[model samples]
Target: MKREMIEDALIQPTILLVEPDDKVRPSLMDNLHSWGYTLIVALSETDAMQRVQGKGEPFDLLLMNQVGHSVAELVAIGRDICQHAGLPPSIPVVVMAECYGDDLEGQDVQMGDYEYVAYLEDGQQLKELLYLLCPVP
Candidate 1:
């Protein structure tokens, strides 16, 4: 098999991405896929809760690209989803923000900011952080 194909075949980490931006969501989704991550996209709060309530596999991470909510709000929403899903406690909740760096890397931050500008700034950075948290290997 081709190297790229073989790489794509690997099981990547699955994350629930809450992005309310109508214009930006698609781009973000495409980037996440290209970065070797599987994403469950939720365009709104209700939509996100519905997905969490569904009979589907629990996501490894909860990432929010806030348009209105604060970091605390993101964490609260993540907590709600975990409880509503009736799954394990403490699903890592990360709010993608303007300020971030290598310190947040490789850590499953629950209810905190992720250096989204840095990680999302580079696909390799995002991949590294997610892989460290989920560890497909």
Candidate 2:
């Protein structure tokens, strides 16, 4: 009998996107899917928590909307997911908002004290930030 080697599985980076806007979700879903990312969508914080703490495969990153929760609150949720869901502590968490006064195109505004938590104001910025966070090998 001959033994065959099993090749290492290729794991595409998975993202949990918590956006409630009906219009925005489809566009983001299309974009991220085209970019080779595995995306999971949740419309509310409750849904996000369920998915995060669920027993399924871990998400590589979290992208949330600030419509329902503040940046601090989202960060806390990410911490909780790490604590309760066995996700890595270093998993990137980014928050998206429709617009901001100082938001420039293709740039993520850094929230103070939680610089790793990006504040994205537009689709371009979100795209740039996502690619930066999970660069393709």
Candidate 3:
């Protein structure tokens, strides 16, 4: 019998997480990492933008925590990054926030041109949303 190569194993999806809070960022990273995700943690929008600009390849998904920034700012940044990267305007972008219900009002934004769910209440919800956006191999 032939042995299977390590490369034959399924590869996990990569996610770019833009979260500013020190307390939340680590925990989120730990959880996602344990879940077999390749996480790129960016502390701020600027940092996140730099990473996206430098990386030659596009991430499977983008997870952003709208903590310090305004909704308009976040949306604009997200849109610009996707457009600059040549990714679809409807690329998967998961926005997590403490005041999502209120902050997200009138955003009229959808992930991949479909209704997007806000994973604000629970961390697991974010993971689930990511799975929906980009399935694990």
Candidate 4:
């Protein structure tokens, strides 16, 4: 198949990205957008919860930054709200952080259905994680 055709055929996953760092958030947004994914970004946990609960198509994945709350806590809380709101709680959640307790990669430190990733990793890695979690139809 031609390159454009292959690209066009790939599904664009919708993501709810929760990041508090001003420096990192914009870069991540730009990267996701350029990679052809639809993005809904939130800078705070409150905003992230509100967005997740509000009316819209269910997000394909949740990409969050490790800030005030732990990855597991965020996923648990978000999934609960999602369930109450009649949303799918199975969608993968990825937490981006500068450091973690041990050497872990995607799905290695999964809590429920969430995964942990180093925030400093390049966009290609993040994109791969999204594809792994929400594969194209």
Model 1, residue pairs in steric clash: 100-115
Q: TM-score each candidate.
A: 0.69, 0.76, 0.75, 0.73
Q: What tens-digit string does per-residue lDDT give for candidate 3 at 62-92?
A: 7777777765567667767666666666577
- Please give, for residues 26-118, the per-residue lDDT of candidate 1 as tens digits: 987898787667889888777888997865657877777755766566667777876787766656666665455677544434333422322
Q: Give me the displacement of residue 90 in model 4, in angstroms.
A: 1.5
| Ten-residue stretch with the least lDDT total in model 1 | 110-119
Which model, 1 or 3, shows the larger TM-score? 3
RMSD of 4: 4.6
What tens-digit string does per-residue lDDT give for candidate 4 at 95-136? 776565444533334566454444444556777767777664
Q: Give stretches of model 3 more than 4 Å off.
A: 1-9, 54-57, 100-119
Clashing pairs in 4: none
Q: Superpose all Cα atoms of candidate 3 onto the true structure and report the RMSD in Å to 1 decimal.
A: 4.2
Please identify model 2 stretches exceeding 4 Å from their true place.
Answer: 1-9, 103-106, 111-122
Looking at candidate 2, the ten consecutive residues that score lowest on lDDT are 1-10
Whole-model alpha-carbon lDDT for candidate 4: 0.68
Q: Which scores higher on TM-score, 2 or 3?
A: 2
User: Which runs of model 4 end up more than 4 angstroms from their true locations?
Assistant: 1-11, 105-108, 113-121
How good is model 4 by TM-score? 0.73
